[model samples]
Target: MSLSGKLETDVELKASAQQFHEVLCSRPHHISNVSPSKIQGVQLHQGEWGKEGSVIICNYIHDGKAKVSKEQVEKIDPVNNSVTYKVIEGDLLNEYKSFKITVQVTPKGTGSVSHWTYEYEKLHPGISHPETLLQFAAELSKEIDSHLTSAK
Candidate 1:
């Protein structure tokens, strides 16, 4: 099997695309408040939030295990409502040689859809595809949508 691969999942949200994208790009640290069970905390380690090259350390839970991922904001395209982050350190690096995540929110009628992409290369072929992590992200998206809709 190939050691490098990409996985994607789309989550439907009641919030507008702009609102969802703004939360991720401008205020990701607030995600911990909306999805405390999944994301415990997010701290800016360098630069500023939402800007490319900024680094953030995220404390989260995956598959019932607490994990930390320090990632650098790689790109942010406001026109497309997309943000990409490259994992530079922490738990996931233990299994994967490299990992990148991109989130794009697009308007769909009255609601929106969040498209999540996970691109990674494994340290060895023994490592399984990150299906569980994708599910975690999708669930986190739903939680954020719930919070955004309720707040308005």
Candidate 2:
């Protein structure tokens, strides 16, 4: 099957769209409270955070298991409140020939909409669609919203 997916969530964050974007784009490995399971660490082999062309290595938990992935910042549009990261190495590369994940925020009233998109090219036809990946994004969005709501 063709492995392409998009997941969107409306988050009522007390922060501005830009602020939310900053948090979303921060090195996931360095953030402490972004998820229920804390990120173990991050190693950036090249460039810097939130900048275009930056490469980041993130270690985190998924399904109660630890996983690591290497990603590169493909695009960062602060004006549009969007950042796209392309997976270049790690476990993700084993299943997908290429994968790009994007997070976009659109402000409305007191809250904002967060859209997470995963575009992937499966390495083989037998690979299943990445529905679980989308679900994970939704969960992360919820966590971010809850964190911001309580911080307000």
| Most TM-score-accurate candidate | 1
lDDT tens digits by residue: candidate 1, 61-126: 999999999999999999999999999999999999999999999999999999999999999999
Task: Put down candidate 2 lDDT per residue, 1-152, tens digits, no spaces.
Answer: 44554444444554567767887676455354567474566667788777899898878676667777898989999889999989998877787888889888889787777878788888888776677767777776777677767775
Off by over 4 Å in 1: none
For candidate 1, report its TM-score.
0.98
Q: Which segments of model 2 are wrong by more than 4 Å? A: 1-14, 27-30, 36-38
True-vs-predicted CA distance for residue 20, candidate 1, Å: 0.5
Candidate 1 C-alpha error for residue 38, in Å: 0.6
